[model samples]
Target: MSDLLARHRAVMPNWLALYYQDPIEIVSGKGNRVVDAAGKSYLDFFAGILTNMIGYDVAEVREAVERQLATGVVHTSTVYLLRGQIELAEKIARLSGIPDAKVFFTNSGTEANETALLLATYARKSDQVLAMRQSYHGRSFGAISVTSNRSWKNNSLSPLNVHFLHGADRHLTQFKGLSDAGYIAACVDDLRHVLATAVAGDVAALIAEPIQGVGGFTMAPDGLFAAYQEVLAAEGILFISDEVQTGWGRTGSAFFGIQNHGVTPDMMTFAKGLGNGFAVGGVVARGDLMDAPHAVGLATFGGNPIAMAAANATLDFVLSHDLQANAARTGAIILDGLRAAAPRFPIVGDVRGKGLMFAIELVDPETGAPAPALAARYMEETRSLGLLAGKGGLYGHAMRMAPPLTLTEDEAREGLAILVTALENIS
Candidate 1:
């Protein structure tokens, strides 16, 4: 362990951090699994937080990348015309059903989101950005400001004028006099009022994670988008869907996350599965919103040939394999299994998600309150038993599982069995 620590410390910066590091250096990955330096393997349910869509080291992606590398033109910024970049943008535009949409590539989700933020701010000329609580956009200044996660805001570097929408708050209280639609309407109304009063003339855009992935993968009540769209359209505010975590086929749907809601955002950002495990992120915008005020975005490595190749091949693989249908089918199995097993355990509070992106919330057996401790215990135990699980939700009480869409029914069943056993141990 000391040797591993010393090696990493000497070669890598301290900024590389996420979950626990057991000094087990990850050396390789294949379909739905990863191996550490010690050569032990674990099924990857998180999919690198939903990035490895077609699974790790897919042969098609590798072949495409290799072909591009052999061509020698790797780092041509948007300045010079690049065929791979043009081809990728055209393909994404066609598949997204937004033919008039323009694509801007970036290095990661944060950069893609940053591009969207700048475009929104310039196009609307507004300082105020509205976002929903428990929503995650990205970690950069503009994206962080618009992201409703308090931890991101509490960190001192955040800029001002980013307002919380309070959409998730109303659900915490019981819906006494209102139906679910009414409750959703009320949330939109609150936003309308906020735009009128707090935003006044400073409203730039309303940014939301269409399905709110890290926010418990919460699906908004029906008719939520129609109401919100009415408010934003009236206020001349651009609606940007931060699909960084929910794009591709993760939601068992095509295009952006907003597609599931049947509403078109003025602009949407995508990362993660867009390039599978490759390093790429992109922002697509409505034709009118494509007009940038000035030269605000010019990423040197944005539309590199290698990344474009990987993304093109990835899109092809997703369509050819019909992975979206698989995600929906397998997701149903996981959800149903959880529902059936919940009665057997006092800790399972709720199981909710769409398609491959799902989470099981743990709660106190007596009070039914969020149980972060139990979640932590379950994750620790699962790892020891050879299963890698992820923790999420605002309270860190939901066990998030977003495996590769290619995960088989038997593999999913095996994972659920491990989860059931983990719960049994806790009980």
Candidate 2:
């Protein structure tokens, strides 16, 4: 393990952080559990950073990939006609709920978002974009420019003129005390104010995550985006929903997180869970906007046969097993359990999220200030207890848990028990 760590540090970029004080190399995974190189089995609550939507080593997905391998054709790009890519694109376009929708495949969420941004700018004929504060899009330069989280935003240089808006993080906003409806109204008003003062003309688009993933699962009030959509429509500003983490029924109540806000965006970007750990990401947009790009655009590895096969199989398994319903039911159980445990753990300042995506924000008990150290200790302790969860927040003080959508009641209870014990130990 020491040798591996030394080699990793020597070869990999320093910014690529690994988990745990002693990082454990994961060897294999089945269902909701994974075995580390040390042969210790752990209940994987993070689900490979929420990429394994159904579960690990799903036979259906495995068989699909195996069948594709037997065909001996995998690298056919978008330049060639690939049946799997077409089928997956058709499935996604139909599921997108945008009228006359079209789908474009990419290799990752970051690229998908970049494609959306490019389409938006070209269609709207403007480079000014609006993004929510304390939100994250991706790691690329274009993505980072729109991302408002200071920790993730490495530099100020950007290609687009980006403006950060309020209402993404209610806990840190001035409208925290307002009721839901009042809060939405205040945010909309602030958005209007920003448009008048910041934007010079018609903005390209407003890109947002229904639930801020890296921002600790923070969510705006219900119908908040819908209200913003109404305003954007008046100005011909496009609305882009960054559904990378919130897509594919992980949010429990809906197939897409933006559905929770009762709004259908002009464009939506998805990745992470779609291919069930395989590299597949895409953008779904209206036909007119999708065809707006004049020059030819193509991705080298986009729409590969293997990725499409995996995504097709993963989507099939998710729908056939009704994992969305499972996510809703099990998510409520975990959410309630965490909320109930919050009072007992003084370090827990807030618990917020939807479906399987939830977070526990840590705080100093007396001052109520973010306690990043305590959060780190909690994460380490949880891992030691045979469970693997994730941590995220603007201040790095949130304990994020996004188990597989197929998590059983038994697994949920066991994870809750372990988390409760971890909190007790921390206290």
Candidate 3:
């Protein structure tokens, strides 16, 4: 075993999973590629688990961080009025789409979700919350209660009364083979029943991920959430869209994934991608909802100037360069490539996703059962052949490709080709 791996295994928790039979230690990166300690460069399909939105060596983001750090004050906390923080908050509020939206920054997606939960439970005066089966919010005492991915939820006890709904394909298996409209209606019916039976029309909120990130890029019909929101609104249940993975035009069709549903959520939380590898996350909501708390709520590392500077620059780069449109164009090509290749690979049970966020489900060729072993083999093979993908699913049988939104046509096709070769070898 490598010395680093030995040390990592000895020190890190067993649950802190690393990829591949022999993991590569990425030391430096540029564009959409990273060079490991052994000097092997790989097309970074996962983008550090979709955190590096604009990719590495971005002069704009680096310069902004440098410019902020040059003043020597990295963090003054939220206690002080900050120019960079205000600038980012204003930009986020405007783009958030929630009427009279107010932004509250946190250091990670988990904290952002925790803040949302606190606000929701407090405002509505109920601990009852709704979440979809096979969804993942974060790994926190409060966050895990609402998160339904079986593998990720470790604790049986929870603070909130989180009821898992049949929101998407995993739990809505009975809706399979139905038309999109029919499937959506079925999910809506299931939700209404759950609210009636489980929460008794007194739920605080329904937290949803427009695209279930750790549940293997699982998404329902676009209108499903809109339908659910209509019902939740009738009962005064706030809708919290967890945009940690699907935010910032990752879905291609919309700036925020929930926008595709044609319903504005009561609140939304975001973390990854905004800082382009830096830790910056926040919750944006209706002014009334965000102001519901009677006590002061502040994060020490929230909206730190350096992180805000990086985020402001990254957002500017994402919008100015029209990377959203690029994701739509390049992602369509990659999606097409996967669909065309899937028929030849028996282990590939399904291919789905939009924009740069995509997934391929591996299964036993003979029984069509979830094949997590096959999934690992694909990851190892892909890394060996110069591509790094991500893994997650209800059963850990999904190979996810969420490259930086700045990926070019050449890079998209290059990554796609490498993925197909990996599939061929693994299948």
The best candidate in terms of TM-score: 2
| Candidate 2: regions farther than 4 A off | none
lDDT of 2 by residue, 49-84 (tens): 889888899999999999999999978788888899
Clashes of 2: 0
- Cα lDDT of candidate 1 equals 0.79
The residue pairs that clash in candidate 1, if any, are none
RMSD of each: 2.3, 0.8, 1.1
Identify the superior model by TM-score, candidate 2 or candidate 3.
2
- What are the Cα lDDT values of the candidates? 0.79, 0.92, 0.91
Quick one: how many clashes does candidate 3 have? 0
Best by lDDT: 2
lDDT ranking, high to low: 2, 3, 1
Q: What TM-score, over all chains together, does every model reach?
A: 0.93, 0.99, 0.98
lDDT of 1 by residue, 1-427 (tens): 5697888788997766545535456688978888877777888788778888888888999999999888786777878887878898887777666648888888898898888888888787866788887888877777777776664454655554777875554447654467777788778768877866776685888888877766777767546866788877876888888888877777775445678767788888888888887899988887667766666557799878888899999988888998888888887888888888889888988887787888888999999889999888888777666677677778888888888989998888887788788889988
Candidate 2 local distance difference test against the native: 0.92
Q: Candidate 3, overall lDDT? A: 0.91
